[model samples]
Target: MSRIGRLWNSLANPDRIPKLFAIVLGAVILIGFLIPLDLNVDQLYPRPVPQEQVEENISTAPYARGGEVLESPGITRAQYPENSKSLGWINSYMSPLAIWVASTSPYFGTSIYSSPGGLIDEILYYTRGFDTILESTILMMAFVIASWLGVNFTMNRKKREAEAAADKSKDYYDPTLNKNKTYYYNNQNSNIKEEQD
Candidate 1:
């Protein structure tokens, strides 16, 4: 057979093709991680919070400043330059959920975990990691399942078609002849021809 004919024959037999394909795909994902380039997203970033939005959210109270209520213009509230913001980020990875065991504030002794945004940011980061793993697992599983189902469906269809063809061949070979009735009719016809003679 030519190369094309050989390929066609192999394709006609698809029992292990899907399993082979799954192995290849898994290997590629495992080893084919390409480092991303061109990630300079800062060049396209529209300045952080826009001047008007920052101004609007700025402290409107009289004690904020004399003429300018905005200390840091165009900065987001998430990055509001408070005294604790830098300290909070430095201690984030350590016990990001709760930095201290005890608290002596008027807010009923709430621990470091009670600090706003500390716990939430850590949770979001780890949750994102878990989500990445889960999403990859689901995608690979889906690929395998879809390929297996498709191959099985094709095989069953081929089987049914083969059975139908065999049935058609059988019909052609057996042309509705009854053995006992044919023997009797043949003998009777010969006797009538002899009587006429």
Candidate 2:
């Protein structure tokens, strides 16, 4: 048989399957929290160039230099925008889910280049929104999972306890029951005593 087949056979047992699933799921969740998303939000539009600089360049003309667009830094590279025309970078420390949620808000979602009204508006509704949403989702999911496991565990424990109690109540020839209990006689007229404890 193949190695995979052997592994599956071993783990497929009723006793081991749940443990295997829990271990694999826990590892995935841990890695997801550790990994960071690669989000460079500079693909939206041409880099902004100030009109004053363009005018200044025209006044101090160099005959040899052709009229070419000057390279300027994109707004998204900055941690925060000073004015209305910056797209700003999302926090690097945020989880992937949080980043996705924050960056995909209505204002930031449709267009990362467009102004989000103001800095507070951008931060509250757009950038930091991911963390809020992710936290709520985690809490909700945890509540649901905990309730499910709790119910199953409680029911299984009760069932096992009831079965044990029922087994104890059964009338068996337990030698520990009573030392002076009378035993039924055989057809051959022999008084056979019950086995000693």
- Best-fitting candidate, measured by lDDT? 2
Candidate 1 lDDT over 21-140, as tens digits, reads: 899999888776764556565542123333443354432111111121123222112322352242223212223222233122223123333442332342333323466678788999
The models' CA-based lDDT, in order, is 0.43, 0.45
Model 1 residue runs over 4 Å out of place are: 1-47, 51-127, 160-197
Model 1 TM-score relative to the real fold: 0.22
TM-score of each: 0.22, 0.24
lDDT of 2 by residue, 1-197 (tens): 68878687666556688998899999999999878877675643223344543444432111112221223222232233454343333212233553365455432223443332333333554546577788799999999999887776654656654554579666544332222332332322232222210
Which pairs clash in the backbone of model 1? 98-113
- Which residue pairs in candidate 2 have backbone atoms (N, alpha carbon, C) closer than 3 angstroms, thus clashing? none
